[model samples]
Every structure is written in C-alpha cells, then in structure tokens.
Target: MNKKYLFIFTIVIVIFAAFFLLTKKPQQKNTDILINGKKLQVELMQTEEEKTKGLSDRKNLCSNCGLLFVYNQEGFYSFWMRKMYFDIDILWINKDRVVDITYDAKKPEVDEFESPRTIYQNKVPADKVLEVNAGWVEKNGIKVGETIVFK
Candidate 1:
C-alpha cells in the first residue's frame, strides 16, 4: 500500500513539473538607447519579426522602457497599434538632431490588430522613431527639439 501511494505521488510531481516547465513565460529581450544625456536600457525589436511582435504580450513595462525603430532614410513614417498590448508615445526624429513629431498612441481594446487608416503625420521627415511607454515623455520631461544621441 505504501509503495502504491509513493508511485502515485511521484507521478503527480512529475506531471506538475512538466506543466510548470511548459507554461513558463518567455524571457524578455534587452537593448540600450541614449536620449538627451540619459542612457536608457530597453527591450529591443530590431528585426521584422521582433517589430511585428512588439510589446504584444507584455502586461507592463519598466519605467523608461521603450522600443526604437531604425529606418534607412528620412521619410514619412507611420505606426499603428497592431498587436500592441500597451499604449506608447512615439517620438519622430530627423537625422539632423531635430524632433519633428510626437504622438501619444493608445492601444486598441479589441483583439484584432489593424493599422490606422490615416497615418499620424509628422512635422519633419524622420530617419528614426522611438516608441516609449505612454506618458513617459511627460514624466521624463522629454520634449521636441531635443536631440537623441545613440551610444
């Protein structure tokens, strides 16, 4: 009888361990960015796959956490809430250390990820864009016309 009870307990423990391993949350990626005089360590999404998967599953972002999008040239750029689980403030920058636009993008409440039909335009052409947690700009006093230096 003791042997039978021990066998059952071992099986149950094995099952629980398997379940825990399979259900473990994915690890977050990290990257470094510099804005103004401050250095920000943030999660990176450099590839197309990573960009598409940006902040979709995350429930929270640490203070000053953000995603930076690098483009080849200065041009008109747009972003939407597609697959995004959180709101962000988008800062558009030109190559000449000029901040052309700032956008406060709200995350979609619905599950379907769709791009906004009309692009949120920028005042100046942008070569790079930085998307940070919502209100991060206001909280950090990050403003337009301030230059972001990449280190």
Candidate 2:
C-alpha cells in the first residue's frame, strides 16, 4: 500500500512539472528598426524611467544604432538635451509613421544649466520617438509621412 502511494506522489509531481514548463513565458526576440531602406540596431524603451533616462550621458551614438521610445498613447511629446553628451536627430513617430522630425538637437549648454532647459517638442502628436546620430535622417533620405517598419 505504501509503495502504491509513493508511486502516485511521483506521478503527480511529474504532471505538475510538465504543466509549469508548458506554461512558461517565451523568451523575447531582438528588435530592429528600418526606415527608407536604412536600418539600425535599436534599444527599445517602453517604461517611463527608460524614456526619461534616454540616450543621456552616452559619449556617442553610433551611426547604425538608435534608441526607440514606445508610449502607451499618442500625445504631443517633448524631448530635451539634459544630461546628454552629444546631439541627435529625433523622429516623432505614430503608428509606425513619421509624424515629425527634429534635426540636430544640440546638447544643453553649460550656461543653460542655471536657466530653464530647452525642450524640443514634436510638431504633431506621436506614440513613438526615435533618436539617432546627428544627420542620420538626411543621410538616409527619410522623409515625413513615411512609415517606419519595426521588426
């Protein structure tokens, strides 16, 4: 009788283990950015903290790399060069479409530190924001109203 009970316990444990394995979440896939036949390996920022920190403090932004910000809703968003080490081009995107672009956004000046920081606002409401190396937009021939595909 004890042997039968032990066997039953072992089967139950096996079933529970198998169920847990089947219900486990899948690993996330790496995402890439594409625009006008140009591409960049990107780092996605979906959380408020990630968006706030942004590309600030980074010494340089690679020509083939970018920061992609995703928001929960479409709204008029503003960006600033606060704590940023270099300039970058900002693309305001909504529904994977380019809504506005801010070119060559400069870093905050030391003098401005004591005063109000300059804010770069998107011309239109956007749900996503992409920051790339300065002049990337012109070099790639990306234009307004063009759709940006994400993979």
Candidate 3:
C-alpha cells in the first residue's frame, strides 16, 4: 500500500509540473541590430507614442543600446531634441541601407524660449530611424550607404 501511494503522489506532482511548464509565458527575444558588421541591442518603437517619446527625459542610455523607430511607409520624417538629456547620433534608413546620418545631435537648451529646439530631417525619405549614443557611429564606423540587419 505504501509503495502504491508513493507512485500515485509522484505521478500527480509530475502532471502539475507539466501543466505549469505548458502554461508559462515565453520570453521575448532581445532584438539585435547589425551596422557595418557591429552588433548592438535595440528596442523597437513601433507605436506612435513610443516614436514620439524616443529617449526623452532619459538621463543616459547604455553604450551599446539604441532605439529603432519603425514606420509603415518611406517618408521624410523629422526629429527634434525635445526634452532630451543627452546627445545622440541619428541614422535615417530606407529599406536595409542607411540614407543619411546626423552626428552628435545636441539636447535642447534648458529654456526653449531662449534657444528654440532645432529639428533634424533626412534629405531622402526613410522608413526607419535609429538613435544611439553620441559618437557611437564614429566609434563603430557606421556610415551612410551601409547595410543594417535586424535580428
């Protein structure tokens, strides 16, 4: 009787464990961006709100982390340093190729009344925009006409 009871208890425990494992949520993959053969982790800004809030009010960003803005169509998109705390390097990409690069875009001044926030835009239409820490492009040797791979 003791052996039979122990066997039943083990089977019940295994069933519960299997159920829990089947119902557990899977983790999302961390997106990696490759530019000029250098890999960097990036967060995708797919929604309008996320695109609008790109790095605003953040004190700092990780050296290898960046934000990638996604759009439905290729169009001339403008970016401004509104409420930005630090400088960034902006890359405008069309399809898989970089169309333009804005190096060391400065943060807005404390008083917008004194110094108006400057807007930056690409010369050509772009479907995506990437923002990384200032000097990241130079350090990684990223340039226009280079391919960007998302994984």
Per-candidate TM equals: 0.66, 0.78, 0.78
Candidate 2: give the clashing pairs: none
Sort the candidates on lDDT, descending order.
3, 2, 1
**How would you encode candidate 2's per-residue C-alpha lDDT over 1-151 as one tens digit per residue?**
9999999999999999999999999655237878987878888888788788887778997779999998989999888886777889999999989999999998878876333278999989999999998999999898899888898
Q: Where does model 2 exceed 4 Å of error?
A: 1-30, 113-116
Candidate 1 clashing pairs, residues 3+ apart or interchain = none
lDDT of 3 by residue, 4-64 (tens): 9999999999999999999999655359988898888988888889898888878999999
Cα error of candidate 3 at position 3, Å: 45
lDDT of 1 by residue, 1-151 (tens): 9999999999999999999999999776666767766677766566778666666667767786777776777888766676567777888878736475465677775645565343455677887777788887777777788877665
- Alpha carbon deviation, residue 26, candidate 1 (Å): 16
N/CA/C clash count, model 3: 0
Determine which window of 10 residues in candidate 1 has minimal summed lDDT: 111-120
Q: Clashes in each model (backbone N, CA, C under 3 Å)?
A: 0, 0, 0
Two-way lDDT contest, 1 vs 3, winner: 3
Model 1 lDDT on a 0 to 1 scale:
0.72
> How many backbone clashes are present in model 2?
0
